[model samples]
Target: MSWQLYEKARGLLSEEFGGIKKSFGGKITIALCYPNTYQIGMSNLGFQKIYYLLNQHDDVLCERVFLPFPKDEFSFKKKNIPLFSLESQTPVHNFDILCLSVTFEADYINILKILNLSHIPLKCKDRSEKHPFVLMGGICATFNPEPLSDFIDIFFIGEGDEAIDEFVDAVRCFSLAINKGKDGFYKRLSTIDGIYIPSAYDVTYKDSGAIEMVLPKNGFPQKIKRRWVKDLNKTPTSSKIITSNTVFGDMFLIEVERGCGKHCRFCLAGYSYRPVRNYSAEVILKEVSEGLRHRKKIGLIGSAICDSPYIDEICDGIAKMGGTISVSSLRLDRLSKKLVDLLSVSGHRTATIAPEAGSERLRRVINKETSDDEILDAVQFMTSAGLTDFKLYFLIGLPTETDDDIDAIINLTKRIKHSILKIAKSKGHLGNITLSVNPFIPKPFTPYQWERMEDTKSLNSKIKMIKSGLKGVSNINIIHELPKWSFVQALLSRGDRRVGELLYKCCELNGDWFKTFRETNINPDFYIYRERDFNEVLPWDHIDSGIRKNYLIKEARKSKEEKTTLPCPEVGECRRCGDLGCVMNI
Candidate 1:
């Protein structure tokens, strides 16, 4: 019975990963821990992409280990069996390396829980050459890593396609050096690109609650250069794809491009992944070729796909290859006639457009500078292109949103729907539109850092106002996200190490979110739904993203006064974001 789970893992693995023995000469055991549930972990395209990559290496053997389900956890507890890899049934402590891939801030607690169950030390200093090398890579570590600094040994920042390939070779070299009686294998690993060893750095806080300095203890680079993969089209993310069950079971996803050209002031991905990198048209066409074989629809992922600069060329390529392509998000300013016409040919009915805010003033405040004319033009273009069903995304509770500003939402939708109805009726085409409204959640490393989220009750009340104004619209569908969930996202996004324990308590209590107030004996409101002084030390202060604090403070003040600030996309070379090293010269 104990080995039943083990045997199933082996059979499934052998069927999918039997060819692993044919890339390296020496045997290497790797445990890929998702640090979340099977359903949650399985859903991640980034996680699965790597799983396929490592298993293809003949010298490297990889297996899956996820945060256990409740029933499986109970079974393990009853038998006193340690957390082990699914493929070889080998305990995690026996593997040479434990690689955790993460996406969100909330998953930090689960990372610790997975480590504890795997018999690994909770602290970085306690682990030595005898145990598995603990490493982490994902968006979280790239931006704000101080909160998880105590636990993770090494962090791989930015894109990992080229970095991970180089990383495996380095790991193999280090292991061989260690076996040959050279003791400094760990230090040697720190010298690689995109790898950050926090233990070698020193952080000092001033009495006034500001970071005095972040210095390296031993010989280390002062500032690490983020890794870059020049041609995304050649070595695109998923060359050999995985087919199985996932959290997003009903959908098939394809990476259209990575990084963003539009530098929305609040976006970290805009700064961290730069130079407007994209996969070539041929690469996108090939991935979609495989996607067409799937039962589900293919999702085109990117910071903004419509602004790919050569989107018409790419969409036309995808259209020539047969498949329904669902894009991540679109900018109204970038939809050209050729692009819209190509979308018509591809048989896409539903699309999403994010204006961010209802009012032009608020839109400009966040550097989302598309005009009302552009939006109406986009609607007309889509109307001509046969796009009837689509969504309009807006953010309520913005830094400077007023009653008139909120009323702009009612007015904007009213105008767009009126045009759609008139255009549809004259042409005898039936078009259905949905307006999705959500509250704004400010995160660290954004220009809105010093700003606070509005209370949930007020946000709901404003939503009610929008609903009342939209009652007269006959054919439009409207959806609003629950403010409470946004509140949880805010809490986790801006929280420190203290809230990590709170996440475990929430998991134990089955996610009664408000219960954090009782369990932690602290007000969740203080950290999330309230404003903070500009002078205080932020929890993410110890980590440097190269953006200055004064710039964020200035932007926050500008937002409050309803003043508009623009990024490079709107103002061109006249604007600079202070993180000059992170931006593209073009």
Candidate 2:
């Protein structure tokens, strides 16, 4: 059984391209561990990007390891087998460094599972010098590393492309330095920019369980500035591996842009990844041409790929090459006819737009900066351009949302569907609309970061209200994310290290978050249902994600007043956010 499991892993890796095949002798053996299944982890471009970057180094040998399949975990534990990597089939614990790519907060428990299966200590302090040093990176780690800080030795607080070289160089330097111990290496690692050694910091809490302060010691910087590649054109991001076993399978993915210029107050990615960046048209087309050789489908991914200045050219180039182009959601206001026409020619049937809120007032509150007319116009253009399927995205439980706003969603969708049907009738076809609604979870570093997530009872009430309001609407499908699950997301998103225990309990209960909460004596309300004061220290306050707290505070105040911030300053000076020393030229 154990041999079968190991072979299964080997078989999966054998299907990939651009994976590292290196000799581990006299090299920094690093296990690039993802706390998830192989199929899911392999699908992530960021994970693939890190693997590509780490393996480019001659002194480092990075191998892939993931949380075992449930059945395989049982088989391994029964056989007393240690978790091993796909490349060398070496035990994960035998590596010098364990670099974890954690994008989602829910995967926190899975990290623990991976540790236990590998026979490594779960807590950072529990591990001796003999054990592999664990470092974490990804979107989740940059903004809020505190939740999993206890278990992780180091957190890379920036883009992997920018931090990987610095990180590996630090590791190389530390290995050769005098006093090759944990403490010495940690201090050395801290000196490198964007590396946060959690143990070097002390977090104090107030009597009300709110953060009092987070103080850094041992010469660690109190604030770690997020790093970015100065010129995005220099480091173009694209898929390195191609497999048919995952989402976007067999589709070559390229990141056209990074960081959103739209300062949507409810979005964490918008603020956490500051100062928009995009690859030039030449670079994008070059990558797309290379991708066409391997796969005919191209997926343009980024927070704001539509905002790429050369988006029309990129789309047209792909269309001319006879390659199908897929994209992330389009910005309604920024939606273009040429792009939509190219997408239609590429065989895309559905177009997605996130209005975020149904009501204009609520849109203003969230700084969505999109109007109803703008959304309808975009939809009309897409529907007329041969796109029949329409997907509208929205968020419930917004800061100032009401029942009227919920009803507006139904009315708005009806208008969009009416437009779609008219366009489709002329083409002798019908249309379908899918509404993907989610409950808003105020995230760290956003203007709404200090706001409370609506209670599950209130969230459920709103969901039902929307459902009833949309009842009997033909050709329209409503899919809402479970609010109860979002409560767990909010808890983990803004939680401290103490929440790690709750995560462990949940794993023990077989992923039962409710029972875990009850058994751990944790009140989900404390994290989700209470509004925070401006004076209170947030869990992620120590991490400088290129945004100022005062700016966020002012933005929060503006949200209450239904005011909006301008789009990101891509051309001129916008001193509205970030610290004084930000690298953004604008």
Candidate 3:
């Protein structure tokens, strides 16, 4: 209703290159909401892809809405203006459906804020036919939707490429049922695979605060199987909207792969997105040719991009088309001179690598498999290819980590710096080595789900140790995430529905989580600092990710013994993880 806010939305729409703006007449309107600022949400490729896919339907008109900037939030509150979509500046509450694309657990509080701003009911049970159905999807929702079950009406699990079509049909059926005053609206949606209606399920907990059982109601499926696009080429995931208002604004992005074959014990992405699939070089080149028309630089996206077999061909095609290429990071063991040289030619001065663990012994515990010698060699190769600066990522509180491993981080970084300096001296240039360190947070469906997170005090001490060890070293920068936030992240990652109450209360206090914990009877440590038994029922047990529980138990045991597992073979029946169906179909 505020003209000032309406003007702001129009200003942003003017800057975008490719965005859908359509008449809402006779259309299934959807407000694609992202619970983050415009700059952060616009940078996400997944969010952009969904918007593109939804608008491709003739009857569907999807618009974008984001959390207001911090300074602008005051005006929104002062003027009592509801949140509006960017394309048409329509009120979000007027849309037929409010689909939330949630990727991080930290943004759970913001979802409540967005709903309150839009004048919508915070709880799903309180919303009626007049209110827009609140649906959610993304990586966080796929693994565990229980924590947000009370708020969302429907959840789309796994990849959204094919699931979106199925959801549209279900929504149509529900709309007809609503007009007839029928009670089977949810039951109609339950028939689709990967569509979870949380209201149709019941969860009971034991006296010890562990989940006892999760039962389905009204003949719903016992387990909701995750759905994924079997073939990567069928769905072309590239940037649909190009604007200079994002993190990687200067480059056009394309997804080269879907999942990682490397089975890292602490990784949720590696386990949840099983049976790794890659986009063919022909498809990638075709995308690059189209993307080059908008931007001169092409950004390749994937879990392990350098491990793709068509890496050289894709880079070569981009080069021949006079387009430079950029990747988020490279695998240490897969680094090649040709790839590094191509990156240098693309005007890239810094190369990023994630060793994850500092010591080789600790790396084995996490199943990283890459040796310290191999990491140093990769750095040497990059420096020789004219890369001056380097960014190294490591986790401080990994399982089985000791003070010796902390010392190893310092020693390994210094060795990498020495390697770079030896090459830089000949070129008369000195480059800085940056280290990004963070505390480890266990995620659901991973081998570390049952493990306890290190206490904040000990994690702080380890961070201080790393800082003190490298204090006097020049041209070496250390940037570590706050330990307290990691504690909050861990609690949310492994929490049940009870934690959602705390999340709502925390939002009411304007994001003061510490005060919320003190006021509530819930013990945050019960979710963060406690290890679980193998027989316990997890909050996400009813959500089938196709990876068996027994396989995760076996992997957890292997982690304790400091054993390493080989990466998934390119094409074979891998029965090790009980994901043979996914592997064989690939």
Best by TM-score: 3
lDDT for each residue of candidate 1 in 359-419, tens digit (9 for 90 to 100) = 7887877777888878888887788678766699988887767898889999988888877
Per-prediction TM-score: 0.83, 0.97, 0.98
Prediction 2 global C-alpha lDDT: 0.85
lDDT of 3: 0.88
Q: Score residue 520 of candidate 3 by CA lDDT.
A: 94
Query: For candidate 2, lDDT tens digit of each residue in 1-586?
Result: 6789878987887787767789978888899988898889988888988898888899999999988888899987899899999887899999999999998987888988898889898888799888999989988999888878878998988887887887888889877778788877888788777888889999888889988898999588999878766787877889888887677786999988888878899988887677777788899999999999989989998898778878888888888888888887888887767788878987889988889899889999999877788888888788889988988899999998888898888788888888889888888878999999899999998998899998889889988887888789888899988988899899999888778788767767878888887787767688788999998888888887878888989999999999988886666556668653433322
Q: Identify the leading candidate in terms of lDDT.
A: 3
Clashes in predicted model 1: 2
Roughly what TM-score does model 3 have, to 2 decimal places? Answer: 0.98
- For lDDT, candidate 1 versus 2, the one ahead is 2
Worst 10 residues of 3 by lDDT: 174-183
Model with the higher lDDT, candidate 1 or 3:
3
